[model samples]
Target chain A: MSDVSSLEAEVAKLIVRTLTLKVDPAQIQPEEPLFGDGLGLDSIDALELSLAISQFYGHQIRSDDPDTVATFASLRSLCQSIEKHRTK
Target chain B: MTVGWLRQRERGSRIASRFMIWMALFVGRPATRALLYPICVYYLIFSKQACRAIRPYLIRALGGPISRRDLYRQYHCFASTLLDRVYLLAGQGNRFDIDIRGLDVLKDRVARGQGCILLGSHLGSFEIVRAIGLTQQDIEIKVLMYEQHTPMIRDLFRDLNPAVADAVIRTGSPNSMLRVKECLDRGGVVGILADRLLKQDQATACTFFGKLARFPAGTMWLASILKVPVILFFGLYRGGNRYEVHFELFAEEVTIDRRHRDREVQRWTQRYADRLEHHCRLAADNWFNFYDFWEEQR
Candidate 1:
């Protein structure tokens, strides 16, 4: 797998584990929406994922950040944002 | 993002809410209450979704088959409490017969300089709780809500009393939980609705009214982590300008060890579900969830 796909896979796995979604990591489409209609994730899941990503990637995910919504849009988007912002 | 029943997408017009507030101010309580009958009739005819939502709840609460009369009564009861909110929020709670039972539970906690969590549901008029906040000078009550879900209603509250609006802690804000923690640390009461799950909220499947349902575990999690008592508050509307606000202590502290966090979250969540079921059964008509609550949204 390419580096980008690998990152997406890792993030998808993290999301499934963190929110305890009743879906497989492979089912979470890289380009599909992570919230609302896509994965049906809510604000509570957003907060939980923010904490998980921050701890795993060593980067703060501020809910108030203007781009936070877009960053949480999909697995690929989240992976890219984390890569761009990760301190470790 | 897709909207769910609890999400703030299709809330009624802000203008209507504003109109009601002004009407209550001009016409007084009895006249404003007469308006609710027509409104209830309107919802009963047009809002099939709301009717569908209440059917199962009413049947379970009443412990018998529901009738058209029961359905209308449910809708009317909901409308009555909502109309009463205008008077309550306007600081005219003295006009109504509000009997607060077990307030000493809260008073004792606040006296000990220890903050507590006031967990409530969408069963009755939460504005009655706000009425309590108005009279109590010793304790500060901060309400935690998802403001974006009901902008028009929140605006109505803001228009009526900005101080109450300012005390609201919007749930999705970055510092929302931090603010709640701070309030609790200051021996201030923090009120939250423990019933509905927000979009993507982690919920534990539990039994409500003998059927499997999902209840949000966030309240239990917060109570456990904060090491504070959790109190259940229910303000039941007893038709014709009378309300009975009951405060029961659910837990002294919600203890969830890291090793068994998920298990503990589910257990305490069920406990809350139990208490909610008991109260909802006692006052069947007051429960007002306007959508299919048991559906698997996630």
Candidate 2:
């Protein structure tokens, strides 16, 4: 598989688990913003993502920060931020 | 319908609702909370049939194939939430003090010169929402409500909440649509519950609780038409004798792809559904839709 599809696959799994989304994981796009423009994730997902990431990867992300919004902007951004901070 | 049977059902259900409400309110406080506990146990649980009806949903959502004993414990939690909703709805409040997290989020939307559609669900008491929203905020909260049973019941609701009576805008009126549009044009807030299926064709079918259920597209359609922010608001009953109001700006999901309006509405509504499910997952019993939510879909 191409690099884009691999990144999307990783993002897809996290999206389904974090948001409890019902759609296909492979369907998630690489550059698509996860929140408003793409998957339409609401604030509840933001809270759940924060909790889920903290528990699984030991990365604590705050919701209020502007960077948090951009960081969680898409599959690529979220993965990069997680990779950078994740201790586990 | 037979007059006697209808009367019986109405009277019986309200009494049941009130009893649970009292239990939730009184059973929480130091002075009266303990006394109300046994009543909550007897009415909400020992009542048997009604309690059993709610079990499967709670079990499926909460315990998730847990052992028998743990399932029962989750039932108790659900029962407690129902009791609290009752309290919030039926109890007397001289001064309803509230703490709304992300209050500014909603306030910010309203502050903009465009009116908004406030989408909520059957999760908690919509009645308590008006009591808080109208009483706490200066913005006019025009709620879209289906008319209730007899004039007597209407009177009872009015007596319980005077502010809401003034604020409620009944659905199905030509005048109601005009008024809601006027509210939007003037930048007021129109509250509508998007969870119930108004009609079969009018709904957006989506997966809920691992099953496909229809959700009305009222929130998306209206917001898209008005080109205004559609926000999701939830009034959560927390551990204290107080509530934590959750105001989320979910307007980002409201899109303008006219070709796929139906699916776009469904997709956007799914986000609303997911957000709602998250809250319901947290406060399992605080909801009031006693009927089988997924029963009609099939």
Candidate 3:
């Protein structure tokens, strides 16, 4: 797997573990949507995931941020934003 | 359960709201409040939907069959609170005799410089709680409100007190929770009215007034995630400028175990419903959720 895909895999695991989703992290398609249709995650899940991301990566993902929607679009996009913004 | 309240049209026009506000401020509270009798009668005679919506809750909370007099009393109570908002928001809180109970519960949190959640319901005037802040100056209270439902009344009150509007963290916005977290981090108090269930909210069934009613779990979720103290507040209007504000410490920190998410949230939500029911019994007319609460959506 490429570096980007590896990072995506890592973030996908975080999402599953943080939310305690019954599905396996490996089952999450990298390009699939993280909310609504794909993962069936709602706003509360998004909030819990954001809190987890902030604690794990030392990055605060604010919903008010213009890129937040795009950043949370998919596992691949989430990883990209984390790469750009992660402090630690 | 269906969220019929969302589709329920906001009553009263801008002109009517403006007239009420003008009378409330200039005509004085006593004189303006007398007008509520006619207003209540008008709503009682015309607004069948509202009357229908509140009937079940009244019957349940009152613990018997209700009369037209009882319904009129409820309407008058609601109108009184609404008119009092004009005075409260305008910083004329001294006009009323407010009896505050369990203030030390809030003071403890404020003194510790730890932010806490004040979970209130539609039972009474939440504005009275903010009025406490007006006098004390120590406790900083911010309201987390769903602004979409009542734009006209909200705008009228917002105009009366822009500071109250400025302090509101509007829900449904992307960054709503983030702002709530930031406010709590600063040792500020955040108040939320948790009675009404929005369409997008995930609800947990709780026995309220001897029947299972669905309450939005969003507040509990936020509290658990934030790991903050949750305090229940009720500011009941006890007729003729007498308001009673009560505060009770609900939880030092709300925790939701991931393995038992639904169970834990349900337990907490039930606890809230129990407390809400207790307060509802205390002031049946103060209950303001004008919708078919127990009806499940198919």
Classified by CAPRI criteria, candidate 2 counts as incorrect
lDDT of 1 by residue, A1-88 (tens): 3344887888889999987778999888888887667997755566667778878998777644678767877788888899999987
Point to the candidate with the largest lDDT.
3
lDDT of 3: 0.85
Give the per-residue lDDT digits (tens) of candidate 3, residues B22-92.
99898888788888989899999999988888888998989899999999999999999988888888988
Q: Residue-wise lDDT of candidate 1 within B223-293, one digit each (tens)?
A: 77578898899999998878999999988998987567789899999998898899897788888776666
Chain B TM-score per candidate, please.
Answer: 0.94, 0.74, 0.97
Better of 2 and 3 by DockQ: 3
Worst 10 residues of 2 chain B by lDDT: B1-10
lDDT (10s digit) by residue, model 2, range B162-245: 765766776643234545665666778888888766431267777777777667776676566556677787875554456656
Candidate ranking under lDDT, highest first, comes to 3, 1, 2
For the record, the alpha-carbon RMSD of candidate 3 to the native fold, in angstroms, is 2.4
Estimated TM-score for each candidate = 0.77, 0.60, 0.92
> Can you tell me which runs of candidate 3 are displaced by over 4 Å?
A1-4, A24-33, A36-38, A63-70, A73-77, B134-138, B296-298
User: How accurate locally is residue B115 in candidate 2, as Cα lDDT from 0 to 100?
Assistant: 74
lDDT on C-alpha atoms for all candidate structures:
0.79, 0.61, 0.85
Among residues 3 or more apart in sequence or in different chains, the pairs in candidate 2 whose N, CA or C atoms overlap within 3 Å are B21-B86, B21-B87, B26-B33, B27-B33, B115-B187
Cα-based lDDT at residue B131, candidate 1: 68
Off by over 4 Å in 1: A1-88, B1-4, B7-11, B133-135, B296-298
